[model samples]
Target: STSSPSSSSTSVETPVETLKSYLSELLNNHNAKRALHGVSDLVWDEEVYQYAKSFADAYSCPADGMLSHSDGSYGENLAAGFSSAASVVDAWYEEIQYYNFNNPGFSMATGHFTQLVWASTDKLGCAYKDCNTIYGRYVVCNYSPPGNVIGHFAANV
Candidate 1:
């Protein structure tokens, strides 16, 4: 068997490339949903990104396959076992099924979708990790001016 150097290099991607892929897909998915509601596109924030990365790095996937939330500083949506950015976002956006536009209030089931499209929550920072657990990878997306506020969901989401 013969192996070419080019083939080996091509098979391995750099961290920058990986990060680019994750972040671009994150923006694309989030902005597409936000556009439907006339909300502004989100811009990446270093602080938020670091927050997410730190959380992802320190996260200990619990036995129940349950994910945890961040300090109430930023609106956060999390998913474990999802690999690609699209899949992570998709898992969260899937919460839309339980959303009630008529009631227009916060529901634990729909919190992810509402946070994804929150009109005033313009900043975005996300991180994804391939971890050592049955859950596989984890994703953390932080939104500034966090969404899902009890009284404000009607207008913001």
Candidate 2:
């Protein structure tokens, strides 16, 4: 039998990879499935949808032009990304707070993920009447951005 040193050591997953897997599993859970179905069934108030459309229209990309989807086919992907990122953020909110208080400058470099989530979900919140309450609570209470992180890029511009 041939044994290599590599085989003796256990593989270690990075925090990011572990978080990604956790988020993936969360989306596959029954509650997430139920929420998704509920979302599909809910209707958006036309006026709200129009307002959201206008907001999206007025929004411009930054110098790097990230999250720019000209044809608007990016909505679903954005939603998925936002949901995943939100899940991870939600799970780590306590730890994030500890880090923020204990280590002021500590950043996980998940800024892009947070930005993507905020941008996508903010639009959804505007467009979906049913989502407004939950989204409001999530943004205001559950998933507040860290002090150094910008919640919305367009807002900063």
Q: Best candidate per TM-score, number?
A: 1
Model 1, 4-91: lDDT tens digits are: 7754331222399777887889989888878888889999899999998898777765546678787759999988777677788888
RMSD of each: 6.1, 16.7
The TM-score between candidate 2 and the true structure equals 0.22
lDDT of 2 by residue, 1-157 (tens): 8888655432222376663454344333313322432322122234433544444434332223233322332222112123444453344332333333233332444332322233223222121111222221111111112122443333321
User: Against the unseen true structure, what C-alpha lDDT does each candidate score?
Assistant: 0.81, 0.30
Instruction: Give the Å shift of residue 142 in candidate 2.
Output: 17
Candidate 2: where is the Cα deviation over 4 Å?
1-40, 65-157
